[model samples]
Target: MLRKIYIILVHTIRVLAKKVGLLSLLESRRDRQSLLYVRSLFSIYDVDDMVQLDLPWWTFAAAAYVENFLRSKNGEANVFEYGPGASTVWLAKRARQVAFVEHDGDFAAVLRRLTEGVYNVSGVLIPPEINPRQALVAPSGRVGYENCDFENYVAAIRDAGGPFDMIVIDGRARNACLKEAVKHVKPNGIILFDNSRRERYRLAIEQVGFSPLRFPGLAPALPYLEETTILTRGGT
Candidate 1:
């Protein structure tokens, strides 16, 4: 299939980049370890086959960082994520409870199937409503949703009962999600914002009080470098 071929091509390019020393720019120990961990996973499974894996489909470096952070919480971390996928399973293994907010019904069913018997995990489905032409733009001003409004999708966390130890913003209308995330995360909690290199998202989070620590590197199944920023609320 076309998607499978694309995945192979991207994985080839990443291997080439690693060989040519482009990946050497990330010389930190943790960064190198993260890359190695992802490489180990790829050795056992195809790049396109990570959906069934227990790893988040994020930058390898960010995944490692989050793993360590979650481990430090002693199985007591309460996590809330905007998107649901492999991460829901991954977090449920480490955290006390993980509540993932999803906007698609079909995918929510798929996730529920994947998460069955994982009693500590729950899904909140808040589908995006169609909006009028003039109100097509998301609250964060991002366009191109074809009139989909994610206002309720972004605000669903408040109703999900959080002051969570960590909040992940990787779904639609991220700027609006980040603004709302600021209110729901515990004072010392962290926010994991995937693809933070986007200008609108970067600017929005920068304006918030959390200090950002960004990890840029290859991600599972994707071509080119991706950045995942972990922002800690309340203090430098």
Candidate 2:
């Protein structure tokens, strides 16, 4: 109940902040820190209904919140959201049109309903029948997504050209996602990982010369709780 209360409070503040045109000027520092600490609360609530990838609720929340901030500041269009995570719903409010990709057909089947009522967002699972080599966008009025055993996702990218300005890699494969990320992500674009807790990601980010942008919380699972560490290729 306390968790719900906190969420309500945070959301209330957010609404009020936006209404009053002071969303970025409020008690945001404390609000951000306070929200991050509530990760333990969201973790127990089962975020599967929101996204197939299960991390902590606070982490997911933090990611969405930070993404909102970045989107507002940078004005990114043509975003390729690679993971089909909880942020897909959140991205609806921000992006003009988002291309959501989910590797698992079963999870995507369930998420399709959740993704509706979103603003200009397209949700499509991988392994398209027409083009088994590429991932499809949403509302194609198509059926039979055959993404179960599709391999060489990089080839799919090669087959489908993309100068995607923003690339979000929030898929289930945390550690190895970057290897595939390099193939699709544009040179000036960004690669944001939803659940960025592992040392491998940290090391890989450094090894690949990607700079850290933001890290919100200490260590929590909520979307809004975790540090939204962003890196724009070599730029911060």
Candidate 3:
């Protein structure tokens, strides 16, 4: 089909561009537009300085939706994020409380610095349980992937004191995160799953009976489109 060919061609072009350093150029241009669009969408004009710094993480669409959602809240919503990065700071600035789980100590340290002096933000580093010889596969049969600390990661999130108003599953073992999130998320709360284009994740979302509001498109600084799905209980 023409659509399939187009997708392949686009992917190939992006791969080639990255090899030649042109991808960065394209992303820089795309990021400016992304920032303007997200700012307009969220009515967050004071974050121009933060947007310009180019800290990598969170798609623009995802951030915009989150910012707008938080803005609509009562200013006392607690947030739990499976990954920590720019989103940690973003949530810290908006939410009354933010808790994030990171798998790397060094990254956690840096995130702490980024969120320092922000009393509402907290990061927990739960390193992966590293099983060098073990291979983990998704339900889609994708192989050669592993998240050794996945079980522990889920436990950490559950034990972190929830019913969170919002949960962002953008880190490792996201399917497991989704499963655990069902219990900890408050009624009518939202769960955001980044890169929901994966078949395994899609299936998991369906299995969990979430009514998903899907935002599928290009994210900030990325050369490709991905799905960022927001799931809510009772199909709301």
Candidate 4:
């Protein structure tokens, strides 16, 4: 609540200052867009903070990537999303089938609540003690979750029964995130990797054997741009 107020106050001051032609004038288009995005974020919070079920830049970036892909692909396409970050629930809404895997128990609980009643979304809490492979063993009558390393697990998912039509990777584990994604996607399937600019995820994608398509430019009022990379499927 208070954070929203603070952002509003800051925005008002900046606007007035800009009008007076002072106080960090918005010289660059990037800066101008930031202010607008900040305002948009705060406004949603003011009206109903719950309007933001997911976190900021990451959530926005992730949603933008997937929405860009699935909004056109119409069909019962299988989507494998790693990491139950704030955006997982939103991804579920767009994909035909979505399975969310989370390493954190607490974060998983919160996400579970947010995802409740969201059709076609299933939440899995990755147990800590067990290895990533065993832990991933799909639950009783539920999908088995292998408590293996993320990369190996993703590869296994593909080799196991993958060749998915679309794969969205947003987890923080970037090194392995994109690599595993390639293994799962079917030829010609689209893969959207969030935060391409983050911690060298772009470079990571390059090493993973997929071609990434960069955006023309960042849109106005968007939190961050230089981070999203779209990879369209080509021949194997």
Candidate 5:
């Protein structure tokens, strides 16, 4: 009971700090690294438009890392994302092909519109359904992976020409998505899981046996710090 209360208090404080601009002030005091990163994002996209549209872009640090890494790779590398949004635009700019699966039909339409002129991007909608009895449960008792339509979710991507060079698991049933991703990703490909600080996901990732490189820090447009982990087969 006390631990839960402490957690709630900490979250509330963070929210308050972000709302009052204290978080931004603190970040500035620490360094201009994050600020510079945000500026770089503006070179590729309009911040106001993205914020208004509510698209999911990686945190500033994560975005910079991914952008740099993808630029260094072959231009023909294909990418698959479990969730589609701003990251789709970001990936499309750097990769040869970008495909994403969204669980919301309305949002999928929005994604299509957003990427309309971008020839190499495609979005597929696979709405989720509830399942009461979960077959798998993590040690932390988080049941996100077991209560969704993950089989069809994975199938949609496979049908869309998978075996992608990069996969991002930032949407629903993430653990289940990761399970499927491992089978579909090219041997040298990488899997990026955002908000990886959650204990349940950490435990789930441990079972995957991939060497993880974690980036823990502030993200663009979000209030607090989070971790985005990069996992590759045999640490490639």
Candidate 6:
């Protein structure tokens, strides 16, 4: 009941922000630029329905930061992502190759449909080994899906054949994914970790020895502020 109320309250605030120009007052200059870039590409769609959106619903600052990195690469970087969503579609258009792993079959099928024509993208579905409905923190200190194991899901990126230039950890068992990400990403690779505001995620990220550049600001279709961190692998 409290979660529902929080959701409603946040939604109401976001709507108010949009209607009353509150975004301008709250956003920094960099955040405003990022929001503009997001609108330029995805102004027509609602991101609440992730399967329906054609662009990544990441925080405006993070999304724009990534778009710039991809552009700088000139479509030559190989990218891997843990969660496949509009980011898959967005990446397919920019990267040399895009591979991802998803735990949700229904969402994976929708993603497959969306990227069917894009030959640069491929993904494998590795559903939870046990209960998909329950939640429990696994023994490895990874939270979420307590009843199931994601050992295989976290390791599946290795099968994607990378040494990838970029990896986005935006799925379940993210701390575990971050550990695996360190192994597969190129020495100079970029790791995009969403929701870095979480303490557990921040703690895990720090232990991995990456230098993080955090973007804390608005995301597309979200009212409240959030954070997405871009970690440079092999940071001293």
Itemize residue pairs with steric clashes in candidate 5: 60-220
Between candidates 1 and 4, the one scoring higher on TM-score is 1
The sequence of per-residue lDDT tens digits that candidate 5 reaches over residues 1-236 is 86556556655665676688865665464346555444223223333345333334566566666766687686777999988767787678789999888887877877877787899987788766556365433111245534544556655777778788899988777777888788888888888898889876887798997878788886654445778888887656
Query: After superposition, which runs of candidate 2 have C-alpha atoms over 4 Å from their true positions?
Result: 1-45, 48-65, 72-76, 127-150, 153-161, 174-176, 214-228
Model 6 lDDT, residue 116, Cα:
79
Which candidate leads the pack in TM-score? 1
Clashing pairs in 6: 136-146
Query: In model 3, what lDDT does residue 112 have?
Result: 71
The C-alpha TM-scores of every prediction are 0.78, 0.57, 0.72, 0.60, 0.73, 0.76
C-alpha local distance difference test of each model: 0.76, 0.53, 0.70, 0.54, 0.70, 0.76
Name the lDDT of candidate 5: 0.70
For candidate 4, give the lDDT of residue 110: 75
lDDT of 1 by residue, 1-236 (tens): 87677657656765886787644443333245555444434322242234444457678888888888888889999999998777778788899999988987977888888888899998789877776556644553455565688888887898786889999988888988888898988877889999998877867988987899999987764546789999995462
After superposition, which runs of candidate 1 have C-alpha atoms over 4 Å from their true positions? Answer: 1-48, 133-144, 234-236
**Residue range with the least summed lDDT across 10 consecutive positions in model 5:** 39-48
Q: Decide which is better by TM-score, 1 or 2.
A: 1
Q: Provide the lDDT at 125 for model 4.
A: 57
Clashing pairs in 3: 129-149
For each of the candidates, the C-alpha root-mean-square deviation to the true structure, in angstroms, is: 6.2, 10.0, 7.9, 9.1, 6.8, 5.8
Backbone collision count in every prediction?
0, 17, 1, 19, 1, 1
Give the per-residue lDDT digits (tens) of candidate 6, residues 1-236.
Answer: 86566656655665766688754544433245555543323232333333334357677778878989888889999999998787888888889999999988988888788887889999999887786454543323345555777878888998897999899998888998998898888886799998899887878988888889899987655546889999995451
Question: Candidate 4, which segments miss by more than 4 Å at Cα?
Answer: 1-40, 43-65, 127-161, 216-226
Q: Give the CA lDDT, 0 to 100, for residue 108 in model 5.
A: 83
User: How does model 1 score by TM-score?
Assistant: 0.78
